[model samples]
Target chain A: MPPPLITARSLVKRFGDLVAVDGIDVDVQPGEAFGFLGPNGAGKTSTMRMIGCVSPVSSGRLEIFGLDPAHEGRAIRSRIGVVPQLDQLDQELTVMENLVIYARYFDIPRAVAQSRAVELLDFVQLADRADDKVDPLSGGQKRRVSIARSLISEPELLLLDEPTTGLDPQARHLLWDRLHQLKERGATLVLTTHYMDEAEQLCDRLVVMDGGRIVAEGSPRALITEYATREVLEMRFGRGRNEERVDDVLGVGERVEVLPDRLLVYVADGESALAELHARSVIPESALVRRSSLEDVFLRLTGRTLVD
Target chain B: MITTRILPSALLDVRSPQRLLERNAMVYRRSWMVIFSGFFEPLFYLLSIRIGLSALVGDIEVGGKLIPYDEFVAPGLMAAAAMNGAVLESTMNVFHKWRQAKLYDSILATPMSAGDIAIGEIGFAVIRGLMYSTAFIFTMLALGMVKSAWIVMSVVACALIGFAFASIGMAWTTYMRSWADFEYVPAVTLPLFLFSATFYPLSSYGSWSWVVQLSPLYHGVVLVRASNLGEWSPSLVVHAGVLVGLSVVGMAVTASRIKTLLLK
Candidate 1:
């Protein structure tokens, strides 16, 4: 309702002769958690960089807060926080010093920068290690420090590029909780991730990107319902036999996706599909019936896994 | 052609660079040994040349004037130290932060631009050079090397030399792809320091005197030597002009190069 915090029209980014981000359009409304989901080299990072006003757009129109990124970069960058794909924390400086100096970049007064740094370190649960240099911290702690540093400016919008790419499960859950709290406080978030579950958990709406193009865009459930069925029947046969009799289970569901070790049957009722498979004497080594998810929708649209 | 705006309002946003300088100061506060190590390098060169080498090489002629060998070499060493300080910060340190540490990548995400990073880095290099020069000048004064009131201008000369080297070093660093590329820095700077008349008169290398004159470090050595001995001449203007022009051109190239590299 607040006139879309960001809008990109035919956004394109080229690195010499390689077109990293092809023509695409995106609009992120205020207070929304939007995601760009894709595998490596899908141009998610390029799109995020263009939105953050750090990378120049090779050709196209990008506007943040109604200002063009090419000419008004400083103005736009001042109000957005970016957590780059890599943890660019200053290893030479203490964790607390990192946040304090970042705060100063926004021209925050010294005393304010110090105090805010204290609070942010506490927020990221790195207060105990505030005096320690980043080199000694764990991967998760370093990421938390980077997140805290990005928040030093109290930005209106936050751009997180692959925020949880290399973290453990627990660390990711912790970061997701922190991000949820931020969203609850009405902070707009734009994140890129290859993790389907991360997108389902964090993004209110997301677009699936592949080879520099958007293949699908919708909320998790809406995408599932539109591109997939209500439930999925997964049956895995012994390694060499999974694809042997694939045609024997043909019309049991709306569609069937064959993977290396399993067969995914998309149907309105997975339990009935399994029953039909049994009735047809197509016994599997293992069978599972569960609700369809974004993973199914993604595979349906792109014909490729999100992580590959 | 890309817009060649000098100190464009985009770059004139000085607050970000100020922040970068503060960050370096904070890091250095904890690692004082790094600063301490830099101090002894120039001091050792001065002590060895003044005490040991000066015994063999007595008074030397410089700029049409005869001065004590220690006096002539001290200020030249000071200028060389300025070059060393600036080049260390701009080339190796900047390259490390850019390639290995990714420090500027984080800074550029904020309101700071690549120009801010380059300026901030050069500003810190100048400050470090000033620290070394101030300490070197003090040591020279303690050794009774001050010849006239014009010696005060050496501080300004040191800062100018540092800025010129810092800008040029940073511009060169943009092209470095790996650590192997850094070997050229020492290979080039070492020869210039030895041949810039830092230890003996440029005339001693008769056939190589023109090479000495061509070295930027030589101009710095001449500038600081003239200021230390109160030997003002129109040549001082030429030395100052060359250093200033080098700084301006280096800075302009560095700014644009950094913009292209990081903002790509």
Candidate 2:
């Protein structure tokens, strides 16, 4: 196997007294799509900042493309593209000018930058709006312009922090498609997201983080297989019902979890568990059988729900 | 002393700094109206106060020569315009880019350092300030208000004044938390611009002349006035030295603050 394109060894970052990023280790290979899956304040963005070479590591070692971030920050930065959580496009410039000016930041020739800016605008489907001012573009269009600006340098490694947090579903899918195309062109991509579907769809491998520490790491499917049952039977309890204990209703399942508003019975076969519940005369307000997924694994590993 | 050698090669990298300055020029190009708005404020002061008010105040004696009141105030107006243009860009524009637009955050991700950013911004501000000062000087010459070609020296004085203010403005911007903090800048600057012997000579105030001498703008006005009258003296060298000293001290403070803020 090839060496990892990015590596972090016992990385730690502290903002004042609060440890924003604990001692976390990660390795991401070239041409691979890696992801940090976590909720807000889970240190996902902070970790991405460190690898992007924008924020210095408070402790431990970080290497990007086999170079130390502290000693070779400029050399490393020149070769990497970063899409920060907040869009930082020059509001005063036109959409195309934004891309062109960003190219200048990397010292790219003006003629080359202009040509590349047009190509990127076309790639993001913003060619018609190229000359339009940035203030008039919709949020989705602005994000697309930002993404295109990042690619102006033709960076070898790309770091995206929560790429589609506040976008509409259609816009999110559009951005995901663009990112997927970038990955197909052999760009090493590292992204952070709280959406399980986004992670499952884009990431080849991912790490789950909670409270600044990695709780688990694996492929989405493998994580589910390792940490969760084959199926999850969600049984919602009615209002104020002093219902029967979960042990009486879900005794046949391998494991049962009694939450405040629902009971989850984990088993190899969800159908049998539902039948057993019916046989025990414990009628739930609602019942559903669903295939196990990363959401289930995250819930099981961290808690009952994802906190933002 | 933080020697300049270890400050980071990124600051000395001319490519990115040139790009950033060009970017600011492009913004000015698109918003020429906004840029001219700053230029017009001083012109209005010159026309309304210097030209119009001159009829009431009559001619004034300066450097043992009888000079029109408007001629004496024209150089002061030019000097003040340079100071205002540089301060506006270095303070409000810099603060907006740093806080509201997050423009610096994106630039910092590139091969640009905070020091490069500071220098580029000050360079652009000085360029604009000189443009305005040159125009004002020509206007004074056209009106038969300039007694000698030495008035061109006022343009150079304007550029130095711009550099000093821009550097200090950048240093002050680092301490600003919000737009409300900017109220103090004009509150302090307006009083200095009005009472710093811009409209009248420092000697006119008698003993109170010492108060006007304390202002940086007073030094700028004195230098421009002396140069306008072709009356260069050793004291003018001292005035230039003071401007240069302020610029160096301000830039040093600004560079250190930028490293602390951006590198953190």
lDDT of 2 by residue, A224-253 (tens): 899888998888876544234565664666
Residue pairs clashing, model 2? none
Q: Give the DockQ-based CAPRI class for model 2.
A: medium
**Model 1 lDDT tens row, B1-264:** 244355544344445677778889998887766764466787898888777888787777776677778787888888988888888889989899889998888888888877778788998988888788888888888988788888889999999999999989988998999999999999989988888888888878888688788888888888898888887888788888888888877776777777777878
State the DockQ, from 0 to 1, for candidate 2.
0.71
For model 2, how big is the iRMS in angstroms? 1.2
Error of 2 at A27 (Å): 1.3
Candidate 2 structure quality by residue, lDDT tens digits, B1-264: 355564443344334557768899878787676765577778888888654688899888887777888887888888988888888888999899888888888988887766678788877777777777887887777777787778888888998899888888888998999999999999988988898899888879898988888788888888889888889888888778888778767776776676678766
Tens digits of per-residue lDDT, candidate 1, A60-138, equal: 8889999999888889999999888889988888888888888888888989989989998889888899999889988
* Ten-residue region with minimum lDDT total, candidate 1 chain A: A299-308
